[model samples]
Target: MFRFLRGLVLPEAACDEANNSSRYENLFKKLDVNEDGRVDIAELHAGLKALGIPLGKDAEETIFKTGDSNKDGQLDFEEFMQYLKDHEKKMKLAFKSLDKNNDGKIEASEIVQSLKILGINISEQQAEKILKSIDADGTMSVDWNEWRDHFLFNPATDIEEIIRYWKHSTVLDIGDSLTIPDEFTEEEKKSGQWWRQLLSGGVAGAVSRTGTAPLDRLKVMMQVHSSKSNKMNISSGLKQMVKEGGVRSLWRGNGVNVIKIAPETAIKFWAYEQYKKIFANEDGKIGTVERFVSGSLAGATAQTSIYPMEVLKTRLAVGKTGQYSGMFDCAKKIFKREGLKAFYKGYVPNILGIIPYAGIDLAVYEALKTAWLDHYASDSANPGVFVLLGCGTVSSTCGQLASYPLALIRTRMQAQALLEGAPQLNMVGLFQRIIANEGILGLYRGIGPNFMKVLPAVSISYVVYEKMKQNLGLA
Candidate 1:
């Protein structure tokens, strides 16, 4: 009974010998209302109606011609079964003949060959469609697994139905119809600390740039292909940068990064809040996990959107010292030198880092805020100062720790043109070389100063953003 019920729910397929005949036999036995080898015209009509197949003009004649092999004006189970078996056999033969290699696999080239043999010479446009239908991976090659998944009907697979359901799920919250949650009252959701946030994050970034600039310069110098150092230690690398470019060259792109970060954080924080609201529960209440998840996703989205600028900034920093005047000049020079795509160099490393960096950073930020509010300012109406300090320290540390290795790879890839000339490192090759030459520790070379930079940078950023939010009352 369960098997029959399951079959009923399954989509209709081309009728086959045993199954079709068995189905018709069951209907014949029901409609005949008496034990008989044949079904009358009236009985046939009733059976067709029951099966949801319409019997219209010349229906009786058609039935006799199709099902009644003996011209007996009615179908017997044996005759019907014979017709079904013949039809099914033809389809199976066609499929087998197309499998030219007889490897039970169908590649694109084989499919094209089969089609030509059958005298259905597909046009280029038509060929593309045929390829797409069978090529599940979009690789332009149809393997046996792909053929079976797409072409062959299997009782176990409902791939199309599952995909359809996935497509239909979750409408985005858009327009005026989408209401903002009111968990924190309008008054309670006060403005952010714009100026304070700005100064703190900005100062931290400036200081970080100053502190780490020499190390960054050294790292870039060591990555230089022409540099004959088969082995470059940090000490030796630093000596090289200082000797070649002078001490001032270490802080080369500090101004550009400082300018970029303020607006970067602005977009990041704003987009994060908006995305949070979107992914958050319809209920006003959101848990720590949800907030963390939302914040991380938001951070990733923001980082991706702004990464081109980061590429430009890094290029300006590590390239020929004093060659580029500022961000705009660097942008222009990069475009002229390597094309616009160069600005998005190291996108893989940049994007991959976002997942873990954002996840850990935002999770820590929120956790710190909650802890501070609970322990330090339990009775305070506004947990502003405590939240800002906690968020700054936690977020920056998490982000730097999670992202610095990828950061190293990105730096190398970005400077490859200037440093190595022509050749560049794909993400895999760069990491492989890093591990091979310097060991795993090589990837985290500048991590010390990076951690130092993040504290003030993130702290000031959040403090400014929160102040702005408080002042604006955007909620």
Candidate 2:
């Protein structure tokens, strides 16, 4: 049996799955670090340590005791997997056995009976609240499937880790738990620091310019040709752009975009700073909730104030086919044709989206920076440049990926404003049209180029901005 299993299990590369399964499997292996076919208290402690889990021994023991089934003093791989797979469900199951009624669900009455049998303590109100949350269908009863599915496919693992880190980290009392080496010179820090800040800022600027440019182009094309009412394929649209104005046609609105980047960056960075300061302390330490609030508000403030300029930029980019004379003409035309409201066509989704985008982006970037700092421990090689690059890649990727759907909505809404006699499409209609015409992937049109362009570009921008501030004694 051992030989057969060994033969079946090739090396790590061979065991890799084709999709997201590989990620889960890798996480599982990290959790099962000992390769001992089971996880005991010692093994669990070691695994937690490897994951940077900083909980106390008592807390660790509580988690382990609840996780280990059969009271066998150790948990086998299967038991460990089961415990991880549906933690809440498994706990409830242990309670459910006490119910003595095969109702295929758990409720307040059920909880009382179940807790009684398990000799556990819980009040009626608590039981009711728990039951309601787990009910899934608002039926006041949580069936096995609902309970299992909720816990089994839980993607809140990161959130849970964040919670754990927050709790333990609070006790550490901030003061550089990680150390910087004496040999690391001030010159090196200076070189890396200012360069990284500028690079990171530039990246944010470039991505903001580039991402909105193509979509602006598309929206304009849609608007201009709305009178004709012909569907535009991604390819044909490109062809039309090139044919109408030569090779430079695709870059028609780039001038306006170039100018817009500075203000957009200023607003975004400024708002982010203000909001972060307001929500957090001087050291810029914040919990998940605070991070979310700060980020969201930052995005909202920046996007809302700069939206008119954004609209102007889009018009210029998309007016390649003689739709509008130039940025000035486009603005004048819009103001004349549709009034000032034209500039703020899709402000609702645009403003609201900033919140989550800022929150997730900042939260992820800051968290990644902290983690990298922990791992590298103030090594000279892990300069501000490296930090900016790493954080930029993560933050930009997360922000763009999460914001794609809303972006599509904003695009359609803005396009609708420019297109004469074009059928008015709500968010649902827009999604349906995209699905029918180009499939689900249509909504994520520029995600690939967005990711590729963002990482290095933003890194450099950030490096430059930070270093500039430091040199100017403004930081």
Candidate 3:
């Protein structure tokens, strides 16, 4: 049943191993649920879930088969002890491997080195936070005993497994349209499954973006064109777009939008890793502010690298039909007509927007989660999946709301040349012109379609991601 799961294991740390049998007994009692002196599959699943180790069906079956010596579909005390002892032996081996130079301890440097081998990069300071979690003595290093005790109940078979969980995104979207990349275990990397995961995510993103392209194009149009003379509401905006171009023109800029996701995500993730090192605190820990600063800087770095594409995207979205052949042609014309500097129009406001977007996103997300916890603590300890997603969606929308004017201005600045007789304005002047001409409401033109696309984008991305995972044997 678990032909492909037999080799997958968790990382092991060493502990006293003294009174190990008794420890096993206590754990067994806990998993036994009904005090029947045995743990069946159902109880075992529940117990593992409580430990926050989500195992797949194949992994669960492999584990169950390994410990059920009598073939009874359950673990008696003796079998359970034997299984744990066997696991500990492997855990000790894992610890020995991590203790480079035969030092009998794992230091932050060692942790960093080990992860780099698995394609996960982190600075020594970032590694220290990981070390602090298991370094009970405040000695800044983990001995075998501390390692074993720290992960006694964890199902992770290797350091990579634990590290993946630690580094995984908490849905703390610090920038508009930016998501932290997914982390993968060593096994996944070695087996070439990491790329598959990335491919799936990219596919999901493409599908989501394409599905919402019409609204996106409309949003860009309204952001650039709406003023005192021309108030382009959603209804009129759609008709105007259709009048100018065919139905398919609604997706004018989508090709480049989908094409840019890969490089943008790659650059953003790489920049984030580097930024975390720079922002690392002396005390070897990262808090909300640190995270925000690191993420904001990373988002800036990524945007700077990809800003040209951003300009191209804006241009293509607002361009008349047959204005340019395609993304390449659009870029060529822009480069030829305007100097390289035009590609970076509105760079200041774009970077400025990141701070508020990230800060408010993080703050509102935390507040929402806290409120959810406060209200539902007695009923449910964990805010279920839907609640978490809801909180994330609302928090992200709030962040966009706070930063939308900046985005609107940035879009206008990019598409200024496309609009004939449109005043060439810097970020500040753009703001003044919009406010003087169309009032405060004009600053948020096209927000209706922007909000309208959010649900469909989220839903499509999620559904496609899950489907892709299953297709790639990751589910």
Candidate 4:
């Protein structure tokens, strides 16, 4: 009976050692250029460079000298193994340095001080969060055993391995419905590669928006002219668009829509990261309210910066074939005719929608994630991919529902200039007129298409985003 139970339980410690050994062997082979069974200083330097590790000549020479035992100039396999063992010893010594009081346990304050020495400016709250993540025994601090167990099996010899380790171990709070990987090494942050985050986010946004472009254009059409004599439903909307400008018209304005994603995502992600630093509590943990405020402000920032493009997208989506040529032509005509203010026609309603959409999306996602973890997971393991997708779809739907009326009003305002004999209305005036003319249901004219696209759009965005990050070696 005991032997049967033993078979059921995995030998995690042994497996971890085997994984580390395999990684070491692969790295050694990579460094041994020409299969010469030895790694010279040049080979080591070349291998490190290939892995994107920035090392000066002096640093490379020093590393080679340290690894080359017995006064030899090259590292044989046994010498390479010894070098790794020495590295492990050095890491343990670094951990011991954090235990300033010689208590064999490292506290939050100690971690903070240690990182400060390495030029990492983190708050005490952040230190506590890091400690909590690794404090497996609920001790609130890492003992020697815990420290050794966590770090010994993850020896990173190059920048790529360090990045991989960081990605696997750290949890980032990006204040979005998606659970994106957001950890960056100190060097990466200092080098101003924050643009990588922007690139990944932009790609994700473009993919999601393009995948749902037809539904999006339909939504715009319905919002602007659904109550007019045309009486547009989804099928009639598609047919009318095709009849007007061919099937390609369904994707009109998509160029501007996709182009704005890079700047918008960059601004939003950068602003949210800055706001997180500002809102972190004494324990470095941001509460739900703080997260909501930050996310809303970030969305507003992105929207404001890209509002002109949004105006162009809306106009192109609803314009006739001869109305304007393309995005630049549309921009030139709008500027020549209506001036800069036309670009911000729907500014108020667009900003207003951000609060409800982001708030509801984040609140629902967190609540569902928490409930699932409580009921299903054993020890705070990450929820499955399908679970995350379900949560994202439900939360996104709720957010869309909460904010659809304002979105409709915004779309109408954006297209108001194109309609002959249409009266310009403020956000409140537009809301009142829509309700009075078309009834409450009128505000949700194209919501069927909107709802139909939300699930697949979000799922594809998240999956593609993760894969892109992995390909870029950021995840």
Candidate 5:
């Protein structure tokens, strides 16, 4: 991007350079913090953050590498001035792109149009709110100087990248989960921060799943076997499991369950990006419908690829000891007896459940985020760790509540579909049978165990992710 920006000589840059010298000097003084002749990484990072245009940890290093010609690890006045001028040139180009008519000013409509081109949809009011932040004179529009000053400290050369950062870092209280694909900046992708974030999240998820394996297995067991006559309460369920197998049986299916998370996340995120490009409108617009379809399709894509593992999970979770020695043995026997189709036993209901789960999860999370920003913006844009965990737990619970019946049906199919001479059921038929035979309450048979796991799972995942992010230099 900068290479393209470099090819164009700013026609007025040299002519107006002298007149802007003092402006550059004052800006340099402000960035230097201690009034020193040189600016360090700390000062630059702080300045950008304070201005609410933070470019993350990699930006400071990139700036020094490009502008710090002396290689002394600091940006002196000359280096600073040079960097700002080049940066301003790029910012000017971005401004012109948003200006649309080459009118030397940006209106809210243009802001909306530019964002749409970047595949982000926002109302005109949202665009106006954005403009107000940079519209220094309150004319409800932004001119060259306002745009330049607003982005002076930001290292992003493109307007889209800037918005990406703003969206993720501010009002960004999210737990580590595959409920939504994580968004990354171009810098994060290029500088390797994206993988660090993913790795952290993956590690967090593995630990969380492992930590909650017992409850997860119990949930599966309750979903499959718990009925009115032999009502499986928690204590009795625990006793029954330990009595049937050893204490270790509580974590029966967790290994395959945890192992599938990484590949599942990778596939989902990759599918989401591709779907965004394909589903974007002629004008590159992405509205809520696009987001919902993309997210649901991505979830389905991930579920499809890892569905064999999912079947294994449900089977192992509910399997009695010695029924199948392990995952591979189980898979081997199923392949031998039931053929390859057994691996995707519950795929129909599983796919159908993705829509409600994704929709409710995203809607709840977004509503919570907007509520947080409205009530707490003056206090801080970022929510605390506990609040984030709570929100994730609530949002996930809501999603699960809306789709738990399908989940129960999916589990039942995955576990019971292998029975000899049993009638197969599609998602619709499974829904009807479960409601008719087991009653509506049967749909939520395992909801207690499921709810019990959310808090601990989210807490463990969030804490591990935060620690990993810090270790990876993302904090």
Candidate 6:
């Protein structure tokens, strides 16, 4: 019985080896330009280029010398295999570097120091955050098993594979303790499942906005009335809103707000895909600059398409008692009273704010991700979820800081018509008026509530998005 089993297993193992040999032979053929059964420097360079891996002359020469195991000027099949084996050895060396003191575990301090060597400055707090992610035993360090498991699927190469892995999207690193869906297969993508994804995103948005509706309403109130005679503090604002409009009034404009999410998410994602295609190189890779440009343009496109809903949402939120019944009533009244342009009340500032917000957010997030990978992620390309959330929160906050004044201007303009005896001001006129009347601080009137909602809102949104993705079988 043992002999029979061995015979069966031996044939299967031989077949597997044959398949690997066939794959390597094909690669060798592709690299052998002159069909000489070996790869010279020129042929190797061309082969690497064809594989979307560009190397400088010095790097190429170094690789060629190392791969020429027989001391020949060219790389035969045996030498090429040696080069692949060297990659595995390099990965082991990288792990050893992280395993300082030869303890077979990497502590947070070691990670922090390693990142410093890579020119990535990180705080001890940030290092702890990263360790908390992959330290499965709550020991604040990564054992060999955990480290190997975390990076089992990642290519055993250097930063090149890291860059390629993150080239698509940074969704994985957007929230604390949230697990995004894995990368989609081409078959799943081409199967007309976009609507499902959009539906999931829209549902997540609605839930997040509704959960944070009170803060959002308070923000609008502060934006429109905090500088007025009302002098609305958070408590007074809540009391005033509740006394006048009842507790349910806190969600006044939430209908239109939720309604706009579907199209906005769908359009932004679709436009991003199109822009990526436009910006991709011949090898279908997009650099960081191209990714930022595509994201900014996509955001602008979505915001433009959904500007009317934004106007309606603000109007309904800041409207007086019984000013308009609902979304349609508000829309009709605005169209009749202020003309078609009313729907685009704050269009300019809104569009202008997109540039800084998207730019800063993308830049900070990418820098943080790259730094984490360089320092904390010894052999792994995946930074822990906590690291992503920390990076995302900081980046989003910075983006908000850079663009808050524009946001305040946009909000004020959206609610302008609702304010009694308020003069209509153009974008520049409004900035001047706010500066003159309330000082530059007027632009940050509701910023407290605005910031108050960021963490919970983002956390809830990401959690729901992941859950919905799973339910839809898209995860």
Candidate topping TM-score: 5
- List runs of model 2 lying over 4 Å from the truth: 1-239, 265-288, 370-384, 436-438, 459-475
Please write out the lDDT profile of model 5 over residues 1-475, one tens digit for every residue: 1111112211123327785676667656767888878889999888655545466776677788778988899999998889888988888888888899888899989987887777666566656666766665669887787677666656787877667544643111122233657767666787887888888888888888888888888888888888887799778898999999989999898889878978988898899888877988786657667777887788788889999998898888877789899999989988988899989877887787777887887788767765665555432334455565556677778988898888888888888854557577776787787788888998999889888888787777778888888899877
Quote each prediction's TM-score. Answer: 0.48, 0.47, 0.70, 0.68, 0.82, 0.65
Q: Residue 336, candidate 2: how far off, in angstroms?
A: 2.1
Backbone Cα, N, C clashes tallied per candidate = 13, 32, 9, 2, 0, 0
In the range 1-475, model 3's lDDT, one tens digit per residue, is 1111111222232344556665666667767888988888888878766655456644566567778899999888888888777767767877877788788899988877776665455556556666765665669888876776665544567655666445433222221464334444556667666777777778888988888899999999989887668878899999999999989899998898888777877787678767766776674445545556677777788889988888999999999999999999999999999989989998888888887777787678667766765555432234455676677788789888998999998999999998888779898898898889788998899899999988888778778877888898766
Residue lDDT tens for model 2, 44-78: 66765555443444445555666677888777766
Q: Name the top lDDT candidate.
A: 5
Per-prediction CA RMSD (Å):
24.6, 19.3, 9.6, 8.8, 5.8, 14.0
| Whole-model alpha-carbon lDDT for candidate 2 | 0.53
For model 6 the TM-score comes to 0.65
- Write model 4 residue lDDT over 1-475, tens digit each, in one string: 1112122221124324566465456667877988989888788778766654435454465566667777778888877867766766765686677887888899989866765544343455555655665566677888755554444323443323322432222211111222222444454565444556556666777888787788888888888889845688999998999999998898898899888766776677778778877987775655546666776777788789989998999999999987888899999999999998999999898888887887787678767765775566543235566777677678778888898898888889999989999998899898899889888998888888788777667766777777766666455
Which scores greater on lDDT, model 1 or model 6? 6
Q: Which residue ranges in model 5 land beyond 4 Å of their true spot?
A: 1-16, 26-56, 69-72, 99-119, 123-143, 169-180, 280-288, 371-392, 417-429
Clashing pairs in 3: 9-157, 10-156, 10-157, 10-158, 11-157, 11-158, 13-148, 14-144, 14-148
Q: Candidate 4's C-alpha lDDT?
A: 0.70
In model 4, what lDDT does residue 468 have?
64
Q: What is the C-alpha lDDT of each candidate?
A: 0.53, 0.53, 0.74, 0.70, 0.75, 0.70
**How would you encode candidate 6's per-residue C-alpha lDDT over 119-212 as one tens digit per residue?**
3455666666656655555677876545533332244355333223333343422111111122333433655446666677678778888888
RMSD of 5: 5.8
Cand. 6 Cα-lDDT: 0.70
